[model samples]
Target: MGVQKEKLVQVPRIENGIGLMAGFDIRVIQEFADESLRATSQDDIVEKFRKESRQFGFDYFVALSLCDLADPPEDVVWVDQSPKGWDQIYIKNDFQNVDPYFAAAVKQRLPFVWSDCLDRVQRSKGVAQPTHDMLDEAASFGYGDGISIPMLIPGTHRGCVSLTGERPDLSQGPRHTIHLMAIYLFEACLRINKSALREWKAKEFIALTDREKHTLQLLGSGLNASDISEVLKVSEPTVRYYIKNAKQKLGANNVTHAVAKAMLYGHIEI
Candidate 1:
């Protein structure tokens, strides 16, 4: 069966302030978080995510660890619940080289729908023809628009949780809620694979103020100090001060290093 696009309608925006979870069902998010915290194994996390994904209209998902891997690695933390035979075709064609979603995942820090990223990539110069070809092939297997939540790991490694189907909710409320869930699920995956957590050894949890954490998150999302200041409605100097304070607390050599450590320590979400 071929995938079908869902017609989107403009919905009234929920009037919730930033840093609040007023629009979505907090109980459901909390329940998922509690369940994720209790998950002791990779299988547990996978099962939990699978069950919850359907609520948002996704039938297939891939929780991938993107490093220097040219091919899929044999690791427990990497979960692939994508369509059957998609992997075989992906490997045969070396689609990894031109997979637009993977290309976007490493650069993006927030959850984004596939079409948005694809459109951006298409508009860019020097885009490969195979990128579009690969996506068309995916649609042949009932894969259509989906969401990819990008996670910036401590080291060079990045992570992405993508949910795909013929049609899924693309509204802001679901996007925001899924971002929260993806954070917890990624943490569970890290917990299941102890080897992955070795380098991120336990240290005294440096407490960062809410503003500081929010500043680092915006920074991680590729915002400059001025951009962050504008977003937070603060002066540029205040934004720089928050970055400086966070850097000192994390004992980082620079702002980028501080953001990386903050992500590693779970002090902020990107």
Candidate 2:
């Protein structure tokens, strides 16, 4: 088996003055497939999405690790392909106090509208941000009027696709159509990622022993070899021996590779 690069489909543009204002930026990043399988480079994939986003009129574009879910300020645009001189302060701070819509979408594995979130705000108060600062920022960026779609692959990771604009009333118009287009685009990207992962796993050969598997499980939870040895009640040398054996068995070049393979094979969870 070899690595396969899944093709992504182009999403249609939404019909509205504001909907047309912000463009669709799509990126699919597969680090495991890229490094292990040597299928596609991260830089090449990012550039492809960047070009698509520009052609579609997206104001910003980014491809990141879905598992990290770090809550950074919105104004601190991690992707430089955005409009400059905007209200960076408010954008950066707005999502700080609220439950990230992207996070919610990923967890639920479904497409969600901003309206669905706002309507359910009362129930989502705890998980969602409820700061006046967020509201003020929303007003500034017109974020209240947008759509969010979650992209998830079974037995894999999750991603989010969001489209925002200044349009306040997206109930029944071009804004809704644009949101639909974005959803289709996100779905295509998700399929591509899924296919790539499957292909990469097929070509990769990594195995682990029972003892090494247990050790890796502990290590994934931020445990050192000494700590793992203490919990397992095994000698430090025994633990090292198991790790070495597992590394050789899995064809891992190092300890980190061994751990990664263990996790991928369900021998360890991260």
Prediction 2 TM-score vs. true: 0.38
Per-residue CA lDDT of model 2 for 1-270, tens digit only, reads 338565576776765654332322222223322322442443444454444333333434333224433553222212223234333653455453354554466566555666577567557654333544565555564444555555554554555556554443344433444444444444444445556566456345444556778887787787888998999999989888888888877677988887787766656778
The 0-to-1 C-alpha lDDT of every candidate, in the order given, reads 0.81, 0.53
Model 1 residue runs over 4 Å out of place are: 1-23, 68-76, 195-270
**Leading candidate by lDDT:** 1
Candidate 1 lDDT tens digits, 130-225: 887998899998887899999876743578888888887767777777778888898788777664454345234677899999999999999999
Each candidate's TM vs. the true structure?
0.61, 0.38
In candidate 1 the C-alpha lDDT for residue 217 amounts to 98
State the lDDT at 190 in candidate 2.
45
Candidate 2 residues lying further than 4 Å off, grouped into runs, are 1-65, 69-97, 123-129, 168-184, 187-270
Clashes of each: 0, 11
